[model samples]
Target: MTVPPEPEDRGTLTISPSVVRKIAQHAADRVDGTTRAERRIAGLGLGTHGASAKVGGEGNDVDPVLDVALHYPAPVRRIVGDLRARVTEEVERITSYQVRDISVTVSALLPDIAPRVR
Candidate 1:
């Protein structure tokens, strides 16, 4: 019989769309001024908000649509730009895929709350 390949050499790597979206979302959350928002429906508490992304495309080209919440009184334009760049860089770096386009939706603007010091 012929010799078999090594265990480490025989597997193919795959990066799923969900994984790409998660990576992009996590990356977006890491930037400054990006924060989680509390979600409510009809005066009921649903849950807290986090940046989310939907990734799609063929081959190694990825298109992600991101929904994010930002802090109030912050520069929205600049922060969104930063978020876009960061997401693109992180997704491409992690997956070795090209991020062709990113669509960002600013879902909410939350107040920047600080804890009181006694």
Candidate 2:
């Protein structure tokens, strides 16, 4: 956990990578064209459901790499741009850390199922 120093010197705060990951996941979920999926390995019995975030850099400077799933029929550029901005804003606001960069990877594209018409 690392906290940025403020002029007021209110006190020291600590933020963990897990907290960043959760923030990113929530941000991704808020995006209309994106969906978080579960990553699983049957043989290894390992899995993670929802968006994953990798935090890099030291102290106040933080870089987040997000892996998320997109729904079909979405505009890749637009969705990615929104996702990056939203995630950065949310993480920075919550942790009070400077978000240097955000990398978004589309892990999968979910198919859009239409309702059947008789």
Candidate 3:
């Protein structure tokens, strides 16, 4: 979904933000260390069909900015970093678009804390 450099006269058609989200989600999921932990669908307006657009010409470059919540068991920093790299690579490879940025938000940490019994 790479957008080609076009003339000013030709209006640049952009893909929907939701579409970007879906693609990001898919790409992230494909990575070994990442998963679709949670999606803040509220007010995001990510519809069921995803996003699509028609540029004036071929090679519509994909401009994506993803806000992802990645979950890790432990060693949060290392895991997160590896997950980020994998996700970025997958997205770029699969979509063939220049990813503006992939923001990894640490939503929760999965640690087996000892249960408290009174």
Q: Count the backbone clashes (under 3 Å) in each candidate.
A: 0, 0, 7
Top candidate on lDDT is 1
> In model 3, where do residues sit more than 4 Å from their true spots?
1-15, 30-73, 112-118
Clashing pairs in 1: none
Tens digit of lDDT per residue, candidate 3, span 32-102?
Answer: 44434332476674433211211121244444443434334656567656655765576567555565544
lDDT for each residue of candidate 2 in 53-84, tens digit (9 for 90 to 100): 78887888888898888888789889999998
TM-score, per-candidate, Cα-based:
0.83, 0.76, 0.46
Residue-level lDDT for 101 in candidate 1: 96
Output the better candidate (1/2) by lDDT: 1
Clash pairs, model 2 backbone: none
Total backbone clashes of candidate 2, pairs 3 or more residues apart or in separate chains? 0
Root-mean-square deviation of candidate 2? 6.4
User: In model 1, which regions exceed 4 Å deviation?
Assistant: 1-11, 114-118
lDDT of 1: 0.92
Instruction: Using TM-score, give the best candidate's number.
Output: 1
